[model samples]
Target chain A: GAGVSQSPSNKVTEKGKDVELRCDPISGHTALYWYRQSLGQGLEFLIYFQGNSAPDKSGLPSDRFSAERTGGSVSTLTIQRTQQEDSAVYLCASSPGLGPITQYFGPGTRLTVL
Target chain B: GESVGLHLPTLSVQEGDNSIINCAYSNSASDYFIWYKQESGKGPQFIIDIRSNMDKRQGQRVTVLLNKTVKHLSLQIAATQPGDSAVYFCAENLHSGGGADGLTFGKGTHLIIQP
Candidate 1:
């Protein structure tokens, strides 16, 4: 079975620029989540999407962070006006449904805001 | 705010030995817990999970124990191997009024296996 997949394994961008990270969840996964991991740090919740319903954006640190999922499948996380603090690995995961279900993750996109 | 924390930042164990990683979580309302393993350069993978209703669950060579009364969780690995060396995280899910709630992750524990 195909696992979750992410685009641009590595991205280097200048400060104040915007970057979009993509994620493709498994074929039948109805729940998708995005998280950020800084070096030597734990994973931080970013956002979650379920089917075609509105995403849970509570974890978005600021208005500069936004994410959207289309057709209940692929998702894109966009960071506006990137700062040095935004440099980290963006991870995407998908689960069969909701709570208690195990999630499968992608390789992640390492975004470096220089 | 509730917090999930690890007792140790790193644990070194010899191959074929049992490994135990401990975690303490706040928020008595939390009903589900999970453990994930992430290797360098890779995203996290689910190792096992335990629900609030149960005290323990086993999967292959891994076992997860949850103590709701104490807000504690533990993951035990049998016959540790070099392939098991990675960062392990414990996460909790609190039951909210709305849809699926977010997961709160604890500081990870780095497992190092010595052959």
Candidate 2:
């Protein structure tokens, strides 16, 4: 079975620039989540989507961060006016919404704000 | 500060030895706990999980223990191997009203194996 996938394995951008990261969840997965990991830090919850009903944007660090999941399959996280402190690895994970709480993750996109 | 945080970021142990990784989580409302292993340049893989109701649960060679009194969770790997060398993360699902609530993770502990 195909696992979750993310694009732009690595990204380098200047401060104040905007970047969009993509995530492709496994087939039939109804749950998708986005997280951020900074150096020597833990995974910070960003947003989550379940069957496209008003994604949970509670974890977004600031107003500049936003995400959208379409057709309950793919998700994109957009960081507007990125800051140097926003440099970190962005992780995406997905799981089935029925029984267990196990989440399959994707190789994150490392964003470097210079 | 009551958040998930690791006491040690790096731990080195010899092969065949038992490994213990510790984590402290705040928010006593966290009833669900999970352990994830992340290798270099890869996403996290689920290792094991335990609910707050149970104090201990075992899976294969890994065991997860939860102490609600102290708000502590630990993962013990029996007969550790080189393949087990990676970063271990402890995450908690804060029981909220929203569907598909997010998980709060602790700073990961990087496990190193000595041959």
Candidate 3:
């Protein structure tokens, strides 16, 4: 079985630039989630998408963070005007459906804002 | 705000010994709990999960215990191996009326297995 996948395993960008991270969830998975992990820190919830329902953006730290899942399969997390504080690993996960299901994670994309 | 927290930042155990990690959550509304293992340079991998109804659940060589009264959760690994060394996280899920919310993760405990 194929697991969740992410692109650009490592990305180094200049401050104020925008970066988009992509996630491809497992086939047939209806629930997707995004999280951020800073160096030596715990994971922070970012956004969530389930099927066609309204996405949960409550965890997005600021207006600069946004995400969208097209056709209920793939998701893209975009960070506008990236800052040094945005340097961290962006992780994506997906589950079979929703409640109490296990989320399979992708190898995160490490963004380094220089 | 409600949160989940780990009792220890790191635990060192010898190979073949048992290891236990503890977590305390403040949100009683959280009905589901899970444990994840993250190795360096990789994303978190689901280890096991336990629901609010049951007090304990067992998986291959692993057991998850939940205490709703004390809002406590513990993960026990039998005969811990060197390959088990990683940062372990405890996450809680709050099922909002509308839909499921993102999990609230606790600061992980680094498990160090000494051979």
Which has the greatest lDDT?
A: 3
Q: Write the per-residue lDDT of candidate 3 for residues B3-88, one digit (tens) a residue.
A: 99999999999999999999999999898999999999999999999989999999999999999999999999999999999999
Docking level for model 2: medium
Q: TM-scores across all candidates?
A: 0.96, 0.93, 0.97
Local lDDT at B95 for model 1: 51
Model 3 per-residue lDDT tens digits across residues A23-59: 9999999999999999887889888888755456778
Q: What i-RMS does each candidate reach, in Å?
A: 1.9, 2.5, 1.6
Which 10-residue window of candidate 2 chain B scores lowest in summed lDDT? B94-103
Give candidate 1 misplaced runs (Cα > 4 Å).
B97-100
Q: Show the lowest summed lDDT stretch of 10 residues, model 3 chain A.
A: A50-59
Note the Cα lDDT for every prediction shown.
0.90, 0.88, 0.92
Could you tell me the fnat of model 3?
0.60
Q: What is the TM-score of chain B in candidate 1?
A: 0.95
Clashing pairs in 1: none
Query: Predictions ranked by DockQ, top down?
Result: 3, 1, 2
| lDDT-sorted candidate list, best first | 3, 1, 2
What tens digits encode model 1's per-residue C-alpha lDDT throughout A20-64?
Answer: 999999998898989899999888988888885644677888999
